[model samples]
Target: MNTLTTIERRAMQAISTDSGRMLIVAADQRNGMKAAIKDAPNGSDAISREELAEAKADLVRHLANHAPAILLDPEVALPAIVDDGVLSRGTALVVGLDASGFETVDGLKHTRFVPGVTPRTARELGGDAAKMLWYTRPDRQGLDSRVAGEIRDLVAECEAEGLLLIVELLTYQLEGESDEDYAAAFPQLVADGAALAVACGAKVLKLQYPGSAEGVSAVTAAAQGVPWAVLSAGVDHETFIEQIRVAMAGGAAGAMAGRSLWKDSLSISADTREQLLTERALPRLRELAAVVDAR
Candidate 1:
């Protein structure tokens, strides 16, 4: 890992609260939102691209003011959200560079960058920083090298363009891996993944809960001074709140969350959606911010 550069430090400050914590609201989801909408009470498989854009716009319009920053995808929410004035001037933007889904090769997962989306493109989209989601399984044979190479290359690319990168690491259960066994290994996976990403020059991280307070401490230690925020992972709001509390108590930087903040607002009537975003989601964000602020 390397020390933060002046540009990187500025980008980090841009996304952080006045108190200097990352309390980011995320609406970068594409496939995840589509699935939630399809399963929602009023949703159908016939969902349109415009609907997804509007949904993302709604999230930014309603909640952007409360949070210091919002995470959006280059696919739907980028230039438009910045051009349309939906995002507050005070709110910093972090654009997602990874594609919506991954590919499976021999029971392992692989990630892809969105075509034409580089750090320069993200900057052109008015992004203060760029985030890429990378799935890692260092313990698996043949994966460690590939994963490390990709992360190191990405960090170099971002540095070349003077853009800050937030590396989001996710781990999945392998083929023939039992639920209990995977669960038992979750903490080490997250900790080792963080260490690997940082070793590859990742200066910041957005990661999943390591399943225990002790696990959270392990990740914090592995980060080697890089800031790491906790992602919601689509858990329920209450559960996510507790997780954030535990994570911050264990020295997490803060959070970059989605579903837990506004999943219920999807596929509903306009009025109902607005109400949920305002009454429920907004408060949830504030409460989460409060947790980080308290820390």
Candidate 2:
């Protein structure tokens, strides 16, 4: 088993249940949030930066108290959410380092970092840890090596600053890739991505569902000793709960769910947002937490 440094251990504890499972609420989306808001029935109004921040704040206010940690982006949910005291003192904060969107190169996706949200800056922002979303395609030649090198550097930076680094790996289909081919490869793509991240020194992971119970078990084995949590990837709440159950049974630490939890609140009134979150999202999260705890 890989032994954690003191700071890594503490940060991990802060974001996990007392039983050591990571039951986190992820609100660290920018483009995804905009899309959710724009797609809402009442979402005809022009979206503003303030609206994004407010949406995140609403999520935190209603749901942060229920989870062990909340993953937030540096752009919208940092100073104001913390400064305004909307975030609960009990929940640990994880600042995201990935910028909005990605660059498509040679039919593969490449990720970018937020210029100002480095490990040191995340720490200064009162973050217990930092997260980066990396686009992975192990089947592509030379891509894995390049991305692995970046993960290593970021891991070292976080270690120097005494902050935990949770690497979130996302696999995308190549341009013109067939749906059947992509579906067939999705399980291995996720499994390979998790193994690459863990080998590159990532201490924690937020991974997409690998598509089956067998694939889930492959991820757990590939993780070695590093703890990994399943990301929601915009799936529906019921689908995500089952994913969590399968993942925990396969040795996953827990979940870091986002759109699956609060996607409905994006287009609603503040009153409705609070009401739905309190009524719908909260129960969904509790069910997820129970699944994690059952592990």
Candidate 3:
């Protein structure tokens, strides 16, 4: 898999130790607000309308310093960022490729933001890789022949660019679905030539880490031998921290995080936030990495 260890090391060494360990800075800034997925847990509760609105604004406000991977719009956006060269190594500058969501059942392939970037853009971005944000489901609910075909093409394009495509789990989450069906369908999804694409080639596979003591086991079992990271699915700050810890405890390679990085506690200090993210936020991540290394 294209783990980008060298890039990670370089980024970490360069980062301020005052910031502590690397808490992925996901920077993919999407278009306008999106509707919450049907089955979004505490959808009506966790984040109130006011809070969610601020989350979007916070995304814009923190553009300069945000970490992890920034999922960018596929349209004529990202110009300022492009000029700034945010794509340099030590960062995962991702492009969001939203399929047929919020409307048509048939998946459509189009670049909505980050205009100039296509699968071909990565090579020029000075990028180690780009994630395809692949989110598909069953025959109709998720993937079908049409969606499958589009994914195949994307894979080809990403592969040609030597990029890594991470299948996003949020799509299904929004659609009110579970990975059980998707995981069960993954073998078939790959068998359908969707796996043969260029982008998915040996990169990190991402999955949801259900919030449970045994949750990681389920995720690991689903991932099998493939390299994978567990996501917290935009949980609250405390829960988010616990989620990352649990994921690391379960042997996840790393985390594909969002929300938590942006969601601040009611009265948290910047110093406390840094410690939580780098230290307590990812205690298990360090432990897991050491485990992988020892092996």
Candidate 4:
């Protein structure tokens, strides 16, 4: 495995506390957040940009105090949160480089980086690490090479800028596959994606739960000593917490989660939202933190 660069090392250190584990709160959803809010009571199907920004900032203000780091989007949340000092001292900032919109072409879905915010730009904006999400499937012809090239470019740019690169690996089914087939295929797909990300020079891996303890072990092993964390994927709080415990037991460093912790806040009034964050989200974050520390 390749050694981490000075900037990469610093980025990793920034995201991880003295415990050497990463517990991050991710609020980088742009389109997804808007969609969730549409379903919220008294919420409009047409969510304005300003509303989305406010919601994301609220998430940071309420949740950032509990985690060592947060993942944010450059286009929406970064400016307001940074200007307002929502992120607490000693909390690392990770910026998402991928743009909104997932395109389906020829039965395969693809996502790519947005224009303007490069790894170097993220570093300039005070981000310690740059993150992107990629969809991976071994059976999907030619997709891996395309995505791998993107990862390679991102890693190279981040290395030059001294920022760590965190890649979130996801898998989608081919045409005609059932949900059960997709679930069954996810474990090996995640393991393969982790190895690919590490080989492509990602410093950290943010991954979906591979569905079983054995799957978790395989992913960690394939990571080749690169730290890997589980993403919540909008599962319930209890389910995500159990996932953290099982993942940590199988050698994951910790978690980088969103939605699961705060999705319920979408429909509530501002005061009640804050109350829920304090009463519900903070306790859950603390619980996950304890799990990571115990590991």
What C-alpha lDDT do the candidate models reach, one value each?
A: 0.87, 0.86, 0.44, 0.81
Which parts of model 4 are misplaced by more than 4 Å?
38-44, 141-144
Per-prediction TM-score: 0.95, 0.95, 0.55, 0.93
> Is candidate 2 or 4 superior in lDDT?
2
Model 2 pairs in collision = none
Q: Sort by TM-score, best first: what order? A: 1, 2, 4, 3
Better of 1 and 4 by lDDT: 1
Residues 72-174, candidate 3: write the lDDT tens digits. 4433234345554434343345545443234434342222223355766654654434554444443343333444455556656766665555544433422
Give candidate 3's error at residue 207 in angstroms.
2.8
Compute the lDDT of residue 73 as modeled in candidate 4.
94
Candidate 2 scores a C-alpha RMSD against the true structure in Å of 1.8
* CA RMSD per model (angstroms): 1.8, 1.8, 8.5, 2.0
How well does model 1 score by local distance difference test?
A: 0.87
Error of 2 at 151 (Å): 0.4
Looking at model 2, which ten-residue stretch has the lowest summed lDDT? 38-47
Candidate 1 residue lDDT tens string, 1-295: 4788899999999889778989888889887877666444555556677777887887887876678999999888778989998899899999999998899887778889999998899989998899999888867723247778888898998998889999999999998999999999999999999988888899999999998899999999999888999999999989999998999999899899899998876653556667778988999988888888788
